[model samples]
Target: MSVTRHKVWDPLVRIFHWSLVIAFAANALFTDPESNLHEWIGYVVVALIAIRILWGVVGTRYARFTSFPPSASGALGQLSDIATGRKRAHLGHTPLGAMMIYNLLLTMLAIGVSGYMMTTNAYWGVDWVEELHEIFVTWAEISIVLHIGAVIWESLRTGVNLPRAMVSGVKTVPEGIKIEP
Candidate 1:
């Protein structure tokens, strides 16, 4: 057996991941069409997305987008593995998981931007913009569902507690796997 030590994730990435989840959920639960709370929550999401994007560029090794955002082919390969029940333990996010991170960021950004447009006088009460905002929200929700489902599936397949890995920032890969530092 061989062992390798790796920096799974940086503090900023871990904190942003969980905070974004909580903020998105809270925004959905607390925001109402008639209340300013919804708009405030949208602003918070915008801020979070902005910070995360910036960090993705300049963050630590494990936090940078280049570190894990896989190519389209890589994602397809991972999907094939999962479908065929040949999954392996990955120290960091799998190819599909990496793609989902991108998806979540883009979706959240779309929701925030569309929501912001609704607040502008030029766009406020504009039927199409409002409709677009609703569409983006729907897309974001769908992505969230898929993300959660993937996490659960990965946990079952790998026997590694993904949620705990995110919390503790360390994953104990089985013998013979090499981790990148």
Candidate 2:
């Protein structure tokens, strides 16, 4: 069997993806919540997300939002594909993956906002603001776990090197696999 390689993730997208991983891990696991480093990492995450949002508008073919918009029906179809063991390679993001991207983006923004509120005079020392920040962090953690698992599962099912694709900006898809445009 022959495999063909295609450029999927652009340079900016790849950088943003890995940079977010590092920043999120640093803030979530390694830094104290009250430390300056944690706050700085949070700011970095906000900036990264902002850049990604802009990239999704004017970036490469695979990086654009038009390449993979969130859709319930499309997600359902991907779910159905998984249930039946159907193999397909998505050049951009699969439907479920697209949904997850949007989810993490929004969740990170919420975390940033809540964390900022905790630093403000009006919301400082407020119990609910702190609680909301914690909640968003926890949700992001759970979502990260699920995201990793899904990537591995889909990679195995479709025989696509998803993690490598993110690193190398290319996906080596097996010939005859149906690739989503």
Candidate 3:
């Protein structure tokens, strides 16, 4: 079977993805919430999200939000493909993947905002804000795990090295596989 290369992720998008991954992983797994370093990392994450938000507006084709508007029907179709063992390659983000990306971005913002509020005099010791921050973090963590698993599963199912594609900014699609744009 022949394989074709498609340029999907731009350099900025790839950098944002991996940078956010490292920053989020550091804050979630290794840093103490009480430490200034943790706060700084949160700031970095917030800034990264902001940059990503801007990029989503005017970036390359696949990086723009319009390229992958969230669709319940599309997501359901993707699930159906998975259930039926159908091999389909998506040139950009899959319907569910786009939703997860949005979810993660918003969750990160929530975590950042709540975290900042906690340090302010107005919200100092505010139980709800702290709890909300923790809740957002937990949600983001869960979403991340699902995202990774889906990437791996999709890669194997479609004969695409999704992780490699993310790293290299290109997707290699096997011949005869139905492609979704």
- How much is the lDDT of residue 110 in candidate 2? 96
The RMSD of every model to the true structure, in order and in angstroms, is 2.4, 0.7, 0.7
Q: Write the per-residue lDDT of candidate 3 for residues 1-181, one digit (tens) a residue.
A: 7999999999999999999999999999999999999999999999999999999999999999999899999999999999999989999999999999999999999999999999999999999999999999999989999999999999999999999999999999999899998
- lDDT of prediction 2: 0.94
The residue-by-residue lDDT of candidate 2 on 41-99, one tens digit each, is 99999999999999999999989999999999999999999999888999889999999
Model 2 misplaced regions, further than 4 Å = none
Q: Clashing pairs in model 2?
A: none
Please report, as a residue range, the 10-residue window in candidate 2 with the lowest summed lDDT.
Answer: 172-181
Q: Where does candidate 3 clash, by residue pair?
A: none
lDDT of each: 0.78, 0.94, 0.95
Candidate 3 structure, TM-score to reference: 0.98
Clashes of each: 0, 0, 0
Give a tens-digit lDDT track for model 1, residues 1-181: 4433344767777888888888888877766765788788778888988998898899876677877876798788778877887757666678888888888888888888888888889898899988988888788899889989999988888666678778878776655433332
TM-score of each: 0.89, 0.98, 0.98
